[model samples]
Target: MRPPFPTPTAEDIRLVSAQLGRLARDVIGIPARCVCGAPTVVATAPRLADGTPFPTLYYLTHPAATAAISELEATQVMNEFSQVLAEDEAMQAAYLLAHETYIADRESILLVPELEGISAGGMPVRVKCLHALAGHSLSVGPGINPIGDLALARCSWTPTVCQCLVYDA
Candidate 1:
């Protein structure tokens, strides 16, 4: 579920492609896997093979999980999370650290000047996308991203049991 997660195998790439309905590009590692061994979160290159500045380091690839997170976002929960972030000082600090951590992790792979100081989601000061934040929490394990951890807690899906179903999208 963390750094020890194995590198993406051919089947892993295939599953991720199926999950995304497109080719999984520049996936350096499978950061998190489903209970059935499918990739739930993929650690992609900061830049694409075509040399695009891709800032999203950890991407949620599971259809079920993505749907669940999307559902939460649809409920206008990001506003509530953003409000909470504005009120909680410790959470703000942790979230800033999470932004720094995300940058560090991506920089560890390869430094992209265009992506400097940029982390996925609305981290540090806002909660824009639960998918990106929850993906970050799932990738690094909790405590590093408090809002992410909270989003994961509120979502209906869980990584414990297998949620692998017919991914139509």
Candidate 2:
């Protein structure tokens, strides 16, 4: 089983800020990291401190992974994944399980009524954002998110590679 979330450090906030080009809000933990120690995926709170509902729990914060998923999105890979979800029963089951897992993970942190039952990446029904799916995959690991796994497989970037941390200065 995966470990619990790690507390975000000062360096984490700095790196996340750099990666996002703005301040990251309600970051609960660094669930996924790169080979060079940079955060690849962050688990965020379901509700922001300002009383806004933030539904996305696992956010992709690494510049390289985000860029790779963005490139995949530009090619309309989501449509292909949606088609696969429609055609395969087993895959659909797994995807639904993935959706359930995402919800449970978020609820484990805090149950935000506004964000209830809403998982990111168009889960259980469609493949909307590869970035979110891939972020989920990176946070949880392989076999949990098949669409995310496939997206990572098709992308140029991999967590095994340490490419982005060099620019962390």
Give per-residue lDDT, candidate 2, residue 87: 98
Evaluated at residue 113, the lDDT of candidate 2 is 92
Displacement of the residue 1 alpha carbon in candidate 1, Å: 5.2
Q: lDDT value for candidate 1?
A: 0.87
lDDT: which candidate is best?
2
Q: How well does candidate 1 match the true structure in TM-score terms? A: 0.94
Model 1 C-alpha lDDT per residue in residues 1-169, reported as the tens digit of each score: 4443467888888888889999889998998888788889999888899999999988998988899999889989998999889998988899999999988888988899999889989876778888889999999998888988988899889989898975532
TM-score of each predicted structure versus truth: 0.94, 0.95
Candidate 1 stretches with Cα past 4 Å from truth are 1-5, 166-169
Residue-wise C-alpha lDDT for candidate 2, range 39-83, written one tens digit per residue: 888888888999898888889989989998899899987888899
